[model samples]
Target chain A: EAGVAQSPRYKIIEKRQSVAFWCNPISGHATLYWYQQILGQGPKLLIQFQNNGVVDDSQLPKDRFSAERLKGVDSTLKIQPAKLEDSAVYLCASSPRRQSFFEQYFGPGTRLTVT
Target chain B: SQQGEEDPQALSIQEGENATMNCSYKTSINNLQWYRQNSGRGLVHLILIRSNEREKHSGRLRVTLDTSKKSSSLLITASRAADTASYFCATDAAYGGATNKLIFGTGTLLAVQP
Candidate 1:
């Protein structure tokens, strides 16, 4: 079994530029999540999806951030007009289900550096 | 805002010693989990303790949860240099009909000297 996979382990962009990150979750996992982890801080949930349907995205920045899990296997998170505050590691995780006991598997995050 | 907050932002100890980290949460939760992250890598789940349980052990890791106090602690005994990493606690918020979203705490950076 493979762990969650993410692309472009590191990224750098200028302020106001657009950037996107991709995630491929573990096989058979039914839930996926995107989180933003600022330096010296815990991860903040951006969005969550269950089998291609969004389960929660209340914390997502609708004006600048968006994510999609089209096939329920792979997902993408995008940030447009990036700001200096957006410079943080974006982590992707997946779980077997919404059950409380299921441990989530995380991917190597994409460290975005916004200039 | 982080749902959980860990105490003693950093800890340094020698190998074969014990390292303890504490985490406190604001709201009720179904379960609490601990994860470890090596430098510049993803987090790896270490242990999970349900609210109904008081303690759990996996190898050298021991976790204790106190629902009444709304806090949890992780104890790593006989630590090794390989155990040097950032440790975080995540809470599964107790909410009706809400997915099990793990809200993480500010991590504790542990450095074990060999």
Candidate 2:
């Protein structure tokens, strides 16, 4: 079975520039998530989507970061006017469902380097 | 915020040796999971232990959870060069009416020499 898929394995942008990343989760999975991993640090959850609806986004930076999963199969995460601190790997993961415990399948991730 | 913190930020050992990593968390959790990430790659789930369970074994990996101490440990026996990677422990905390979220630890960088 194919795993989660992400686009643009690597990205570089200047400070204040905008950047966007895309994710296509595993087939039949009902839950999707976006996480940010800084160098030498563990990944932090940014947002979660359950079938076209947001399940949690309390940690998301409302001012600069936004994500959407319109059809519940694919999702996109955007960061506008990026900052130096935004230079980190963006990971996308998917699970079978949200109502129970299930292992998450992660994508290769997009490594964003903001100069 | 990271829910768990792994001890001994890094470890180096020769092949065929045993490697152990510990993780401690602050809040109550439903389950704890371990994941491995190779250089510049995404994380792969290694094992998961529910709070009610004490220990679980999967091949060369053994996981022990102590809820009373709010800590968990991962033991990899007969480690190999292929086991060189970063191991992270993630906690699944229940919130907002049965929904859960996973918060990862700082990670332990393991280097196994062949």
Candidate 3:
């Protein structure tokens, strides 16, 4: 009965570097989501997956940000050539499948710092 | 941007006082939810109100959703210093069916003085 788990609670890298984050959703959850939050702002949706198939990713920066939910269980978010603006907290969330109203459980998040 | 926008942006009150925060959204939604985040970390789900419900309560928390006005309000009665954190309002504008997306607002920072 573990909550959503994320690795590398904190990360610091220089601009133009690359970083990856891993997430493990609660067991039996079928929906996964990744969000990016800037300082003093709310979290913004970067990508969503339903059973390993992407449901949305319109807000994702395709040039550098990429995420994949493998086998509908775990997910990984990667940012290559990270830019200064990409410095923010990345959050992962999950929910039960096909729920009429989403009640998502969130992870602590990975805080990325770009120098 | 169907995200709900929380008003005031920040609030500070002493322990045992009541705290009220308002949220407004531009689009129609099926439900509204509130979340609490501490220290810019994980967000904890607080409450969820369906469009049909006008008001709901949980312990010291009270939530009112006004679909007619596309707005909502959260009130914490006799709040404690431990309640200090950032509160956010999220809306799911799934009009036709299931969009499975929650649009979050900018959030309100609440600081409770002991």
Candidate 4:
């Protein structure tokens, strides 16, 4: 089976610039998640979507970070006026709905660097 | 803001040795999962242990969950240089529907010298 897919393996942007990252979940997976992984830290959940509807996004910095998973298959995360602190790897993952035991398939991630 | 906490922030071991990492979570969880991330890459699921299951195994990976203690452990037997990566434990909070919004730990950086 094909794994999750992400675009632009690396990105470098100046501070205060805008950037967007894209993700396509695994085939038939109903749950998708976006996580931010800063250097030397674990991934932190930024948002989650279940079939086109958001399930959770409490950690998302609404002022700067936004994500959308329209149609439930693909997702895009955008950071506006990016800050130097925003430099990190953004990972996308997917899993079968209602299966907490199901393992999540992750994408290669988009590593962003804010100069 | 993190749910799980992994101990021994870093671990270095000779190839062929066993490496064990522990994780402690704050809230109750329906399941716990372990994942590995290579530098500059994404995470790969290693194993998942349900709250009811005490242990699970896959290849050289063994994961144990002790819900009573809100803790879990991952043991990798016969580690190799290829296993060098950051290992993280994630928990699915027991509340709400199963969205699989895993809250991850700080992670344990493992370096296996061959």
TM-score of chain B of each: 0.96, 0.95, 0.94, 0.96
- Tens-place lDDT per residue, model 1, B1-114, is 798999879999999999999999999998899999987556999998988999999999999999999999999999999999999999999997446899999999999999
Clashing pairs for predicted structure model 4, backbone only: none
lDDT of candidate 3 over A1-115, digit per residue (tens): 8899999999999999999999999999899999898999998999989989998898998999899988999999999999999999999999997455769899999999999
| Per-residue lDDT value at B56 in model 4 | 92
Would you list the C-alpha lDDT of every candidate in the order shown?
A: 0.93, 0.93, 0.91, 0.90
Candidate 3 structure quality by residue, lDDT tens digits, B36-101: 999745699999999899999999999999998999999999999989999999988866576668
The TM-score each candidate achieves on chain A is 0.98, 0.98, 0.97, 0.97
Off by over 4 Å in 4: none
Model 4, span A59-109: residue lDDT tens: 999999999998878899999989999999898889888457788889999
Instruction: State the iRMSD of every prediction, in order shown.
Output: 1.4, 1.5, 1.9, 1.6
Clashing pairs in 1: none
Candidates, ranked, lDDT: 1, 2, 3, 4
* lDDT per residue as tens, model 4, B1-114: 889999989999999999999999999888899999886555888888888999899999998888889999999999999999999999999887655678899999999999
User: Tens digit of lDDT per residue, candidate 2, span B1-114?
Assistant: 989999989999999999999999998888899999997556999998988999999999999999999999999999999999999999897555445479999999999999
Q: What is the TM-score of chain B in candidate 2?
A: 0.95
Cα lDDT for residue A56, model 3? 84
Candidate scoring better on DockQ of 2 and 3: 2
Give the CAPRI class of candidate 4: medium
Residue-level lDDT for A8 in candidate 1: 87
Model 3 alpha-carbon miss at residue A73, Å: 0.8
State the local distance difference test value for candidate 4. 0.90
